[model samples]
Target: DLTPRQVTLRDRTTIATIVPFSSRYGVPPTLLQYLSDTMNKEIEGGDTYPMMDTMTTDAFATYWFQNFGAIMLLGTYASASAVTEGNDWATQCLGSFYIKPNYTGRSSHISNAGFLVTDSARNRGVGRLMGEAYLAWAPLLGYTYSVFNLVYETNVASCRIWDALGFKKIGRVPGCGNLKSYPDRLVDAIIYGRELGGPLDEQAGEERFDKIRFYLKYGTYPHGADRAEKSRLRSAATHYRLREDDVLMLKGREVVAEVERQWGIAREVHERGHGGINRTTTTIAEKFHWVRIKETVSDVIRNCKECKDKEAAKTAVVVPAKRKLDGAAEEYLAGSEAAPSPALRGEQEQMVGAEQNDEQFHVPASPPQADKTLTPHQMDGEPYYTSLEYSGQTPNAFQTEPHGDLAPVHLHADAALSLDPQIMGPMRDDFTLGYPQLHDSTGQPQFAEEAFHIGGHEVGRGRKWEG
Candidate 1:
């Protein structure tokens, strides 16, 4: 009757017997400590700031165990040992589990988590093994998919493992995490996810698993370095494969040489012909014709005016000598070296002295009467005194030389030629005046005009003249 008399509501719920806590109810303190320690270590080691600590671990464990029943407890138990192996392993194992449900309401597929491990425990298949285990377990925990919401882009090892696990990248946050070894260089945070219950063939799953294992062992994907190296090698090989002949052709070497040779031959042919070369008429094929060169040169030699004139003079008919006009005239005429009479020397002595006086002092005479009877050629050729008209208007007096055949005279028109007293007078009087003088072989003035004329018209004092 001691307890049966009035059993209180609180007493009723409490049993008198010693009831032990279920083995499932209480986790091993060592395992809990390990999980907490591993998670804390991984979060600290990660690139992101404001990481989880002991308090976070306790909160996560309380929420997970409270809501999800025995499943969460079992997962916690399994993940504890995995985390002790390495940071990567702990991240992969615990990264998929959701401690708080409905994180994004309707879009709760977006999940974020991390892992922890000592440095010495890496590269031993621990990270990959845990990743595979998580993929296998995620669907049973009512998760449609698992996501690595933030992963540093420069974390090559972590990226390789996740990619090999068939986790497709969905998004990226630029410059969200620190690049390892380069604290100042921020890296992109990569978002990755994989469907929990999506279509997955056995072969594809096996292939993916195999790839993860390969990455763990070799630390690279298929065709990574080889692909890049092969492309570089191909480019180099293409560059070296070009032919020397093709290169010469592209530079037009043969074409340029052919053009130069043609030009040389054309110049030679034109010279041999003695015909003024017509550059426009010259052709490549014509330049190489030896027969044409000979023909043209022969024609030029046959028509030479200087040779014809010399031959005509040499073959002229002879004329007999006439009787002497008087003894004085005879002596003067005979005084020549070829004289046939003795009387020529006495008369020639008187004439020679008079000619010497004429050379010493002379004056220009008045214009002569027009010789209307003479031809234009004869009128032009005759001396000025003999050709000038008394009326100051000789017939065709202003006419140019016949047939425009005036010889090309070398005229000294340089500024130094102005030193002549006669030239300096006109040049100083009219500052724009130019004095041009015909030069003899010895560079002395042969002929000069006080006021110049060309083409029968007087040139104005200041006008430019083209000789």
Candidate 2:
């Protein structure tokens, strides 16, 4: 809980008292509901908060007061002890804020806070009073640093208050905030950070893990850094330990590559049969730590020329199915001068139905949602190849599921190396690059380039696309 402080109203003479309540004991239900409604109203105004949908009172309470309750500013000038709420929270409160750990475990010392001032309290300086009090109370609550991860650039007042209070702009992301006010345009978001009880490093340490490495090497804080700088570094070292004097490990997993490993890890996971988005993201997340990782994986899949070629291959294969249907209809009608009897028609339709259900022509059934997430490597299964070329000498045509189409799925270049010598011989002799007709490994009957093997599977991005 925060100490009672006097916050002057817009008139300057009218002083309002601010008080805080702890979440562990819980705020009153009615008051929490009132605050929820006020915050929901602010969300709808489309100026401050970015959340498009309003939350229920219970959800709002859990979000705001779940970790740390809230510091509430009273509207009346009457001393905090002299006042009591006879009506509702709306009439009694001017503003409120909650402070909680922004990141869990090792980074728990760094706190994040959300602020709200009722519409009636605008221009009354209640916000600044809360900010000043926050600077004092956050450290008291055990936070060493405060990070405002998504302070919208459009929120000029909030930016000014943070700037005036000596918080540094640690980072910025472009066009990341899909704000309601700017529905047609995405807005940039600023990452603001400050030491709770002292000044912040203007550079934000230049590198995230550098100080940890330095401290681990020397058994002390960085040279020439002040008390605040040393304190920040000390806090960051909590989750990390030197496993091999050079390698950093968190718990059991190696903490690697702040930015260097994102693309390579995303690509490696992606190139394993070009799995779906969920598979690609989950595999990397389990082993690596980095910012903007999900976005990176999304970019890899979205821009992959090989995957795009596979998409176009789907369209190419469907045309042959239509031709097969026309050819089948002509063959069924030939030699029959008159309409066949219903019994005969029924027998012919049954035969066609049996042919449709044959494994070679049967369309592939969708795997369960759970199975879709496991990449071929994770499942320890082989990549099945889709039929693009006919194997006249062996049983390599569409056998898995064929409805005028569908084959054994697809084989990656790595998997192709395991094929029979006879099959491999023909594949090698005819292999050429530049978007050749080959199946996708995603179990979908489609064409793909770059992942195909011509003579045999070669390492590194599978038969590299020559410029």
Candidates' TM-scores?
Answer: 0.32, 0.41
Give a tens-digit lDDT track for model 1, residues 295-356: 23333333344544567898773432333444322222222345434364444554444334
Clashes of each: 8, 10
Lowest lDDT 10-residue stretch of candidate 2 = 370-379
Off by over 4 Å in 2: 24-26, 75-84, 199-467
Alpha carbon deviation, residue 380, candidate 2 (Å): 83
Measured by TM-score, the strongest candidate is: 2
The residue pairs in collision within model 2 are 360-402, 361-402, 361-403, 362-401, 362-402, 384-410, 385-409, 385-410, 386-409, 428-455
TM-score, prediction 1: 0.32
